[model samples]
Target: MFWNGSTQATIQMSTTTPLLWAAFRGAVGDQLPVILALISAGADANAVTRAGDSNALMLAVQSGSEVLVRALVEHGAEVDRAADEVTPLMLAARIGAARIVGSLLELGAAPAVRIGKYTAAEYAWHGGHDQLAELLEVCAGAPSRYDQSS
Candidate 1:
């Protein structure tokens, strides 16, 4: 039981059930109805993996589903929850998910949060998403390290 010492073991176990698995998979597949049903059924919007990382919001970002992202956020997902130093916003920026990025920002995701040596803007820049980088920079209210002219 990797979750032995965690206070959320019950919730964690509940998340491991087939129903929750379906919810997670549906979220990844951008199936809004499945996610809606699971959430309405009392599924933990913030439920992490067995390792206690990567929630539905993070997965929704990876899936590039702005709808799912909005649903998760509405269900009380932490917009800034970091998974391996990368927040959902960072992941969205890296993938050039402008809609998702905007949704996260509107939900109060911090633009200045750093993942190691880079902010979300830096990650977007490194990923060759100039527009996303610029968007993140504007949200951060700070200039990006990479020259926009280049």
Candidate 2:
């Protein structure tokens, strides 16, 4: 989704399950233990909110918690899946989360994939994360120093 000139994302009504909500809160709050407990209780890591705007993995990336990201992915979160047209890889790259980006790549996230006209490399570049942009470009098979800002 395109930004609406707001620093905050548009909040949407949520009909998400309690387990899902708890997991999401855990991710967002950096409460990994709670998330792990929920996971053990059969929480679906891929379950999204009613608006389909987010999931545990997305929240974890937004929180910049690599451990939470890894745990969620290991519990079956799809790294390349888009929420609000943004992939976890793109989010991580945009935030300059190098470790999380590396983890997502190891989890089989496709560096060449895009949401609309935006690639992860392009997101990184637009966010002023040059190193992440270069890394994503190289992973996508583009030459080093490839300009993704176009």
The reply for model 2, stretches above 4 Å from the true place, is 1-30, 146-150
The count of residue-pair clashes in candidate 1 stands at 0
lDDT of each: 0.77, 0.79
lDDT of 1 by residue, 54-112 (tens): 66787778766788888888877788988777898988888888888999999999999
Taking the candidates one at a time, how many backbone clashes does each contain? 0, 0
Best by TM-score: 2
Q: Could you give candidate 2's per-residue lDDT for residues 56-84 as a string of tens digits?
A: 78877877778888888888888788989
Measured against the true structure, the TM-scores of the candidates, in listed sequence, are 0.77, 0.79
In model 2, what lDDT does residue 106 have? 95
Worst 10 residues of 1 by lDDT: 18-27
How far residue 56's Cα lies from its native spot in candidate 2, in Å, is 1.3
The alpha-carbon deviation from the true structure for residue 55 of candidate 1, after best TM-score superposition, in angstroms, is 1.4
